[model samples]
Target: MLVLDLVATLVFGVSGGLTAVRLRLDVVGVLALATLTGLGGGWIRDVLIGVTPPAGLADWRYLTAPMIGGLVTFFLHPQLDRINATISVVDAFGLGLFSVAGALKAVEHGLGPLPSTLLGLTTGVGGGVLRDIVIGVIPTVLRKGELYAIPAVAGAGVAVLGSRLELTTPVVAAVAASVTTGWRLLALWRGWTAPEPVRAAAAP
Candidate 1:
């Protein structure tokens, strides 16, 4: 579980660092943003689950991964920018992973299915929300045109259901995460857009 957490943190950390780089932040700012984006969701989860002092803070490795991510981006932004096309793929994979991990943890902590699903989504997107808000941009998960949260919800739902069904942990997590990552990738490839709210006609 810690390994999965660290992996997701590293992935999110890279995205956060890349955002900092895009905004021309110095190394300190980059690391700060990376730390927040990498561990924000897990922290939110731990708090909701009544676990004081989240894993990211308690476990040195969790913090270390994000710092490494920041350093990589800080020094190698040019190489990363050159391969920018793969960035979204990495981000989507992390989203799927986090969602599954979140849902499983919630279940382990005795949360019901509905709450677990929601927590899964939160764990999947909360870090990015923190990153975006800190950077003064609308969070992608809250934006209408993006299919981000939908896939996350689907993945979390699967994990929750699988847990209830007594499936093996590894199987449930892998399948659920794959569904999420696959759906998100398909949306990206196909330019799929979530439906937007229609404005009501003005009264005459």
Candidate 2:
């Protein structure tokens, strides 16, 4: 769980740093955004579950992961840009890992299955949502027709169900994460989207 969390943090942090670079933010902005994006979801989860101070804040490794990600993006963004497509895939992987990790933690804390699933979904998207809000943009998960949150919810549900069924944690996490990452990658490849409300034609 620790390893998975660290990897997810690094991936999300790199993504945030890349966004900062694209927006021409300074070094401080890049590092700040990276740390926020990496740790925001976990912090929110811990607080909601009544855990004091949050695990990310208490752990040096969690801080280090995002810091390294920020530095890597700061120095290597040019090379990173050439692999934008790959980064999206990796981001999906991070989303999956986070969803499972969050849901399991919630279950460990005695949250009901439904609440755990919701928390898991929140964990997957919360960091990105916060990052977007900080940068003055609408979050992708909340944007019309985006398919991001649905996959997360589905994965979280699966994780909760697995826990309820007494499945081993490793197996449950693997399956849940694969479901999320696969669904997201499929949506990206196939242009799948959530349903959008139809707009009436403009009045003449």
Candidate 3:
């Protein structure tokens, strides 16, 4: 679970750094965004579950992973810019990893399955939401036609269910992550979208 969380943080940091580069943000902006994207979700999860100080704040590796991502993007943005699709694919994987890890952690903290699932979804997408808001864009989770949150919810739910069933941690994590990553990738490749709300007709 620790390994999965760290890898997810690094992956999200990369995603955030790439977004900053695309926006032509300065070095500080890039680093800040990376750190927020990498650690925001976990921090939120920890705080909500009464874990003070947050693990990311306590662990040097957690802090370093985002720094590395930010520095790498700062130096290699030109090359990275050409691979937006690949980055999206990787971001999906990160989403899956975070979701399962968060759900499992919540379960360990004695949260009920439903709460664990919600926290897992939040852990998967909270950072991205913060990043988008900081950059003055609507969050993907809230945007029309974006299929971002559903897969996360599904993944978290699966992890929670697996835990309830007493499945091994590794097996639960793997299956839950696979479900999220696969669903997200398929959505991207096939242009799948969440349904939009209907607009009322205008008065003449």
Candidate 4:
């Protein structure tokens, strides 16, 4: 589980750095975005639980994960620049993995259904929100329409519910994550977005 967390963090960090590069940010800006996106969710979770030092600071791996991700982006900027589609694919996988991990950990800590699910959503989307804010764009979650948080909520719910049903943890997590990832990617490919309401004209 720890290894999975680290890998997902690195993946998100790389994608975040890629976003920064696309925005034409400087080196410092790029690293900053990567690190923040990598650690923001864990940091938020730790702070919420009053965990001293926060997981991001206590674990060297957490700090190093984003740095490595940033380095990857730095060195592979040219390749990544021409591969926007690749980034989206990788980002979806990262999102699903992290959502499962976050929800699982939250349940382990004794949170109930709603709170645990909320934590999962936060974990999945928090970093991306921070990354976007750093680069001066609205977070995807807050935008007109995106399937991001919806799928995360679905994945988290599945994991938590499966645990309550006494299923194996690893299997539950994997299934939930896979489902979430599949749904998100399909939505993206099909341009599935929330419908905008039609407004009535003002009374004459």
Top candidate on lDDT is: 2
How well does model 2 score by local distance difference test?
A: 0.91
Better of 3 and 4 by lDDT: 3
Task: Give one digit per residue, the lDDT tens place, for model 4 in 1-204.
Answer: 778777778878887788888888888877888888988877777677566788777889889998788888988988877887877787787778877778887888888888778888888888988888776788977776677888888998899899889899999999989877998899889977765559955777
TM-score list, all predictions = 0.93, 0.94, 0.93, 0.89
Residue 90, candidate 2: C-alpha displacement in angstroms: 1.1
Instruction: In candidate 3, list every pair of residues with a backbone clash.
Output: none
Model 2 worst lDDT run, 10 consecutive residues = 195-204
Candidate 4: Cα lDDT at 80: 74
- How well does candidate 3 score on lDDT at residue 155? 93
Off by over 4 Å in 3: 1-4, 199-204
lDDT of each: 0.90, 0.91, 0.89, 0.83
Error of 4 at 159 (Å): 0.9
| lDDT (Cα, tens digit) per residue for candidate 1, span 130-184 | 9999999989789877799999999999999999999998999999999999999
RMSD of candidate 2 to the true fold? Answer: 2.0
Candidate 4 TM-score to native: 0.89
Task: Quote the positional error of residue 114 for candidate 2 in Å.
Answer: 1.7
Candidate closest to the true structure, highest TM-score: 2
Residue 190 lDDT in model 1?
A: 92
For residue 61, model 4's alpha carbon misses the true position, in angstroms, by: 1.7
